[model samples]
Target: MIWTIKKAIYRAMHGSLKVMMVLFNLPEPELFTGAGSSLKIPEVVKSKGINNVLVVTDKVLMELNLLEGLFNSLKENNVEYKVFDDVSENPTIQNVEDGLKLYLEGKCAGIIAFGGGSPMDCAKAIGARAVNPKRSVLVMKGLFKVRRKIPPLFTIPTTAGTGSETTIAAVIKDPDTHEKFAIVDMKLIPIVAALDPELMVGLPPHITSSTGMDALTHAVEAYIGVCGNKLTNENAEKATKLIFENLEEVYKDGLNLEKRNNMALASYYAGVAFTRAGVGYVHAIAHNMGGLYGVPHGLANAVILPYILEFSRKDAEEKLAGLAIAGGIGTPIESNEELSYRFIEKVKAMNKNMGIPSSIKEIQIKDIPLIAERAVKEGNPDYPVPKIMNQKECEGIIRKLLP
Candidate 1:
């Protein structure tokens, strides 16, 4: 069966990679799986012998009283902590600087990225600053130049989007320039990721919907990306299914525990898949738009997903067909093009069902030149994304949403 072959390939790749790591000087992330993952916090901190932790969170988390359980657990374990609730949606360089000041001043042993991606990213930047405070974090933009070993770090994601919890990248927008920059060193990757569905139970419907679409975008990009290995493929496929089946139900009823659990798990798997396989032009472009426009990350991904898929369908047919099948479209389609288009249409329909906007104009449609130009140059350059687009092509993708 296909599932059997996929399972076998995943095992072989994971196994051989580990073997070569010790024998051939290869490197990768420290793999940790957390199904019932809450206790992982204590485990990783204790294992690393981290005596004190600076919990980087945000205002909403502190206001809504969402962090009580985790704080209680840390208190019970005798872990000294400080709270920094200043991180914003698109985290700024100032946010990182302030957080880093707190981290150093508290003399915390490690970091706990205890909120969504913004706080998580702030935590990474704070840790990176701790090691090499003099270096311009902006100068270390693209790959593997994180100069020093950061302190022991852990991430607990309260929402499902952005996956900064498990990824080796942190996106911070410079307040002075209002241009987004990402630091993609392996040092940014967390030591352990804690995915607790209970934490997401408080998410409002709008946040739930947008974050779910973010996960869906991750799977779509990973499945279709050129660098997709067998392991990434399996995770993407399973994550796609989980999102399509559960995202809408949870949107309509945010209190649905089962759907929340499914979305949380899907978000984690999507993070793992995209971390290895790489995201595509949608993400690259979306980042620019978010930085410039103040649009939410997931909302940007949701609005542009179908339009970008339509543009890339011819080049990404086979992979798009795989996603179509995963989304429950059958082989009865007349042609590969038709199948791919149908899948795009299905995503649009899903977005509609979840109350997402049908076009970029809904959130933003400005600074086309800057957004398109920077998209190609940012975030992912190493992986094999399906599309090989130039500036004109990127501009065209932007024009689709223009009024």
Candidate 2:
């Protein structure tokens, strides 16, 4: 009788979940990333029928000339291109405005963003806004405004992080509101994502570590998310395995192209996974933290990953246990609930091993109430939190981390 009742409950719950799944209308970007063939930027440009290209990058990349090889490729293929390497780490609306100015001034047919998330995101906004100046980038937030027939976009990620190349979402800060808003649109998906591990060899250790954590966060969130689809599961598993294997090696030695390649693949896989499944409380809160403080997005995510995962255990125990196994922690002797705790511990250990700090004390969340309120308001609050976090509970969590 008990077993029959349990089965009936399970069926009813799953039936409701299936109903919800059909309603959200998720999106998944087509992924094209790997190593060895990452040097085919010119081929990608040609395939897109691109005549002139605007390469978006950072001033640091320009100084390092990390893109010399790509420039040579453009020259080798007799491809006409303009360089717009003025973007910053966390790009502002003005950056997009400036890049669009250059895009129009050069009258370029396409854009090639050849850097980390900031540059890639900037390029997407510039690409989208260029096609329809009538529709503001801010107004295009949330799902599916990326439909405009913009020029072709080629993204070559220099960092084995961000996975921005593989995601349809572009994050740009609004100066008026000071929020790191996300523009999720299929049209923002790059026409081609060129993955070259050689380009990541120049990344410093700090960046490599932070970005690896970012990749890990994506995988963790996607694997256990409410909207996690089977297709996302396939990619998330690959990302989890690759990140577990290669993140340490890349941190220890950034010049190892093979390790960099694997890490790059991990980031790409996680990006693909989360682009559809969507991230959870960690990302939502981290986004707010980034907006309020000048915290690096990856660092902010890394800091709160374990905390959020611990809180999420109440709702996602089985999912967390699954993550544990994927993260190489076999099922422990305890219940699945305990296994979830083990998973959280393992993640904490991984962060510590990778030199990621535990708290936002570095960013100094002195005003705990303010940070918590903003974290919930700018993030979860009424947006349908996956785990149902109340204000006091959220503030309590933030306060606990302050020691």
Candidate 3:
């Protein structure tokens, strides 16, 4: 009964948000893609008339020297910047607070998000807070809450996943609840995004596979969701094809810049597709897994994706079948149902080939109800999931993901 009421409230909220989105008609960011596009970040910063900048990133990226190219560009351009490398795998509100503090203390004029989803998300949250200092990050949790324009924000993604570079949403977890929440507003969108495959070449095989699957989930969910339109479908189709073709090659030979570039483009395309159309139950549950069990976001999404596809098959058959053909898993002559199953099998095979485990070993049975409740709360109405799952149904799905 509580879940029913929560769903009704979320549905109502989403209905109003759809109306608001149409009313506002937000614009997407300028994107630069290729092997050396990240070198353009300093130029973009100068063009925006920004002097001092806040660089939000993680220690791993720094240790790997993945940020050297961007740092060199900034130095060559004589741009002053402060680095805050404390962002966690699942960024917390505290991370945002700490970054924002640094941004203010340094009197930064702009933000350069310099890593994966966590840093990008933390940077956006910091940008939002810089503009709206009166409101808490907690108050800015839902759609269209950010009314003011944030400072100029630029992104240089070291991973070919999350698509946070192009998306207008940011996910941050609360320290008290250990639950993840999102800030969805056009103001959170970066002014510029650099999808430079050169930065991604050093990713380990496991990271490559997991992040590739994450991109796949974004594309597949966007294609299957009810909010998808013709433009989004086109992007999703292309993203699916690129990921299917390039992910394995890049996973096998991490230094292959050509395959790496293709995977980066696939991630960008998936990001664009899902930013407008939105993702589905896979992300909805995966976010909870990350928050609750410390599961890596990409790995969680990769493991949860096939099961959700199976659950959504009845409603998303034609779309999934189309994706199967786009992904080269099925011929045009195959029936939609057969094609859909073939697509599911292909995903499973890809996971096996990439060394992504089928189940999450850390998921506790006792936590399913809470995870299910949070998943439903996060996905209902807004996500346009083929089937709306109640707590019990969501628990059933999570049970299958357990070791």
How many clashing residue pairs, candidate 3?
0
| Better candidate number, 1 or 3, judged by TM-score | 3
Candidate 1 Cα RMSD (Å): 6.8
Per-candidate Cα lDDT values, in order, are 0.78, 0.78, 0.88
lDDT for 108 in candidate 3 is 99
lDDT of 2 by residue, 1-403 (tens): 7645644554454445445544645443334555545568776687667778899999998899888888888888777888888887778888998999999999999998989999999999999989988888878876576669557888888887688987878988876776778888777778678778888888888888888889988988878766677777788888887888888778888888888889988899899877766676677677766676668888888888888887878788987777777767765555788778888887787789888888886446556676667666544421322465656778877765664
Q: Pick the TM-score winner.
A: 3
Cα displacement (Å) at residue 267, model 2? 0.7
Expressed as tens digits, the lDDT of each residue in 183-285 for candidate 3 is: 9988888889988888888899999999889999999998987667776788899999999999988999999999998988898889888888789999999
Task: Give, for candidate 1, the lowest lDDT window spanning 10 residues.
Answer: 20-29
**Superior candidate under lDDT, 1 versus 3:** 3
TM-score rank, highest first? 3, 2, 1
Q: Supply every candidate's count of residue pairs whose N, Cα or C atoms clash at under 3 angstroms.
A: 1, 0, 0
lDDT by residue (tens digit), candidate 1, 188-293: 7787777777778889888898888899899888888666677778888888889988988888887777788888778877887777667777787788767877
> Any runs in candidate 1 off by more than 4 Å, and if so which?
1-40, 331-335, 362-366, 379-383
RMSD of each: 6.8, 5.0, 2.1
Model 1 residue 260 lDDT score: 80
